[model samples]
Target chain A: MSGHSYDAEKYWKANLRLIFGSLIVWALVSYGFGIVLRPMLSGIPIGGTDLGFWFAQQGSILTFIALIFHYAWRMNRLDKQFGVDEE
Target chain B: MSQFAINIMFVGGSFLIYILIAVWAKAGSTKDFYVAGGGVHPITNGMAIGADWMSAASFISMAGIIAASGYASSAYLMGWTGGYVLLAMLLAPYLRKFGKFTVPEFIGDRFYSKQARLVAVICLIVASLTYVIGQMAGAGVAFSRFLEVDSTMGLIIAAVVIFIYSVLGGMKGITYTQVAQYCVLILAYTIPAVFISLQLTGNPIPALGLFSTHLDSGMPILDKLNQVITDVGFSEYSADVDSHLNMVLFTLTLMIGTAGLPHVIIRFFTVPKVADARWSAGWALVFIALLYLTAPAVASMARLNLMTTVYPDGTAAEPIRYEDRPQWVKEWEVTGLIKYVDKNEDGRIQMYNDASDEPGTAFQAEAEARGWKGNELDVNRDIIVLANPEIANLPGWVIGLIAAGGLAAALSTAAGLLLAISSAISHDLIKGSINPGITDRGELLAARISMAVAIVVATYLGANPPGFAAQVVALAFGIAAASLFPALMMGIFSKRINNIGAIAGMLSGLVFTLSYIFVYKGWFFIPGTANLADTPANWVLGISPLSIGAIGALVNFAVAFVVANATDEPPVEIQELVESVRYPRGAGQAQDH
Candidate 1:
């Protein structure tokens, strides 16, 4: 029982860490690049406007797609490593 | 065939497909009704979610708002899509592991309090119902404009069709129908965009075309747009907004609100497994991004097109004569969404920014130099998407297709919202509380009845459509963001949050958000009753009522944490449930009779 509990704790901690990291990237891309630092990054042009405009309008959404798929893949691997994967 | 016939064929054909899907996938039992028998594939579920989540606003109005507002309106795109990321990571998988039929069921069980569940149910119902009214009204507009029907008649037709499929097959029917709807709407959206993009930039992909040099002008589309609009006295198209605080908070409000919306959350419950829930959210975004990516292209291109249309040679040249307005304008003029008046009585349309108080005073010099009066065109923002293909002079078939697509977007979301509303009433309010011992058959009957009732109410409200229908949607998002989202997130993450704490958090969040909105938007959105005027001057630190949900969410979290520390922890069994949900190891198919 103790060993099982330990493994569960480890798995949960790993999950939390992954979520925290992904959320950072999420916040950074949308709020950071898209809104807060848009002016600073205006020097870097994408299509017509600056990189920040692209991120706000197009880039953040594409990154969100990649992030979800990446999280699903990474989490599923973590689940198996912890023997927590649903049979 | 006439354009009207083509429009009818397109719309009627889509209706036929929906009815057929309803017959084929008709719900047989309570499980089928609630969560589509829990057998949906990840990709299929994703497409359904795309259709279900986009709503009329996303399809018909969002691009218009973006076209008009430019970079600031990117919040709609980022906020709406970013919510899926939160859902995949924080909510969907855990909820799937818990294996509930409805969102409130999880809340009810997790907090071990009927009161907590009831609060969630109320929030879910209010949000979903308010949101559905917008869809109904949007569908009515689409019908009136395209099919040449009265808007009220259109609402009833839409209602009858929703009743047929949703009542017959419930979520099962809705899921399949939405897949078809997604295809229709996406094609309708992108085809015109592709044509316009090719026209403007020689780029096939609209997303790429936005950045590419315009073939005609030999300059990037955005640069040209910025130059022209500013030349005519509009702000830079891609200029950074004035207040970072409001933008961040507004975008965050939309993100959390999207994640918390009951209709969207319940779509996850339809997928078979926890992992599928995660993958499904990704797939849904993939399908949605097809339209979303095209939308900005559509917006910028449409804005540029409108500008060039009015100013034939350029802003320096003579504007088009009122009598020589294009066929599209003439047609839209009939709908009254687009009106042309020679404000200067010069017989030529002089469309330029006329608002003296707004930021773009540069237009004043241009206007005075050109001998222009106030802007000649009163163009409603909602006409952008509807008028895009016409603006680009795309073939008539594309126009017909867009009509179908608009209806599909509206109907698919309406069905999804109706299902969420009905399930909350029947599953949580009735089966879970009022009569736990009711038979599965009885519950299914109740679900159908409630769905029918919800549709009737939505259609009636849509037809009458109070002056504040649009504002009510902001209320819906506020309720979900402040109340349901915080409660659900806390319930999953913390076993220490007891019923009392959860209840307190929900009530405080809901009340704070609602009162903030009501205080500015008028108590309950009644016009002129506002304690404080709904303007930037009266706002709390310049945070609009529309963006207050983010602060309301913070209040929920702070209050819940403080209250939970002061009170006892949740029960041992509830803690065990949390532990079980965390692992996702034993999540079988959602429990069914």
Candidate 2:
């Protein structure tokens, strides 16, 4: 494999993919379940109240951890694709 | 031991640990002083940074701030952590690749101008100083609260502890000590939270307990809280208060600011490789999570605890007779953080948000029913975390542990900030500019002296302290966000960004952001000097002073880009430097030069 010669476009595209996907989830857990979609999620009770409150307090934070990990994993793969992966 | 003696013993034990760590890991030479010999493990470095980043505000007050204000407060949670992500991605790895001793060194070398380095130095000092003062203040508050002492005495103790370790250890010493501090703090924070969670929700983990059913209420505790709180004319306990636009901007600003914080970013320089820097950030967050996750639970449970204690029958009647209030309530009341007045000459407590004039409103009704004048309880939000365990009637050890944790948070961050400031002074100010021909020994001596000066300043400021923990944290975040972040980003990302552009942008952002806060907050929050009333409603564009840095950052980018496009591109060698910084090629062994 060529050193520092893999596709820049692919790298850019991969970053975009990760960003948008993780952002969508971030928005969903935080905004969707937390506020905007809170009433909609009120039907599915977490313990007693709807899922929205959980999303606000605990869900958003948990999702952030997952999001960062997902990004790290995807970006590592992208790094390998671009031949920028450190030995 | 008396509860006060127990508090002193626990706090004394923590200081002993920090001092021991400092002595064992104290810097041996200039190399050891600057970057911890670049030998730190990713995990250890992460904990060090977590301690370094959490500060007294995060450990003691953040959750209460969030619980009290509702949605507008989510910014602190999302933004502060989000900044770490930005740090990992945009700044840390690249900066580590540059392999510098100080942030100003990066600016000077990248921009190839002493003026640019000077600009970075000024910003670093201002941001670090403002932030360190807050930590000092936090340390003082922590000492005062648990030690049964006045805050001024607490400030002096915090300062002395910081001076001993920070002046002795430098960065190398500070790093190892921070690791210990991180442990002490996390344990201190979690113990009480666990006990409270178990009591309230039958869950051991407070984070999980937040969503669990309340054993007492026969429902999810939050629902019960909302029901009871709103019945007394309070907004639903779980309701959101901030608009989406403000929340997003506020979070973004904090993220950007956190990423930009000179002290936290400098922690990455302690590790060996670019990969270590990346992993170090993840680790730091993990350590931070140990406390962060527990904080909200502590907050929610604490709020619930306070309410229940105040209103056993869920109203003003027989409100825990003033003389019969819990030991914790009596203890905190003396701090002036909690106040009670038998205004009606009644022996009962009537705590309600009676600000609403609408007679039919729940709060007004509760007040009228109870013969209360207004929201009688004036509990300071900062006390929520510190007083939670005691409030719940948990064992003495848990309360003692919290005292240790709050001190750890303040000390670790203070040490980190001081190191950043001192390194900038010794490396950039003296060696780089004041006396380029200074010997290695001289540089080392200068570094030590500078560290001493930084500690003295931090100690002095902390001793006096600006009084508010979260507010001070916001100011720290605002300055860091406004100035350092933009300069660092442009330095690495834009090769064509000339020294002029970098300096101009930094100065512009710094002056704009600081002056904006000052216009409303008065010069240094010295009351009677504020030209405009200081509140969210009076802010320009409805942006809180906390959010001004985000706007300032935009100005920085705009000024930088326009200037860069107009100027000639950076020299070929500079471009090479940029490319090398981008990829970690041949950055295998970070030399101890």
Assign candidate 1 its CAPRI class: medium
**Tens digits of lDDT, candidate 2, B506-586:** 788888888888888777677688888877678777777777888888888888778778887777777667767776545
After superposing candidate 1 on the true structure, give the runs of residues whose Cα lies further than 4 Å from its correct spot. A1-4
- For candidate 2, what is the DockQ-based docking class? acceptable
- Candidate 1 chain B: minimum summed lDDT over ten consecutive residues — where? B465-474
- lDDT by residue for model 1 (B461-528), tens: 99987756778547877888999999999999998999999999999999999999989888877788
TM-scores for chain A over all candidates: 0.92, 0.85
Model 2 TM-score, all chains together: 0.92
Which window of ten consecutive residues has the lowest lDDT sum in model 2 chain B? B584-593
TM-scores for the candidates: 0.98, 0.92
Best by lDDT: 1
Which stretches of model 2 miss by more than 4 angstroms? A1-45, A48-53, A71-87, B148-151, B316-318, B357-362, B465-471, B523-526, B589-593
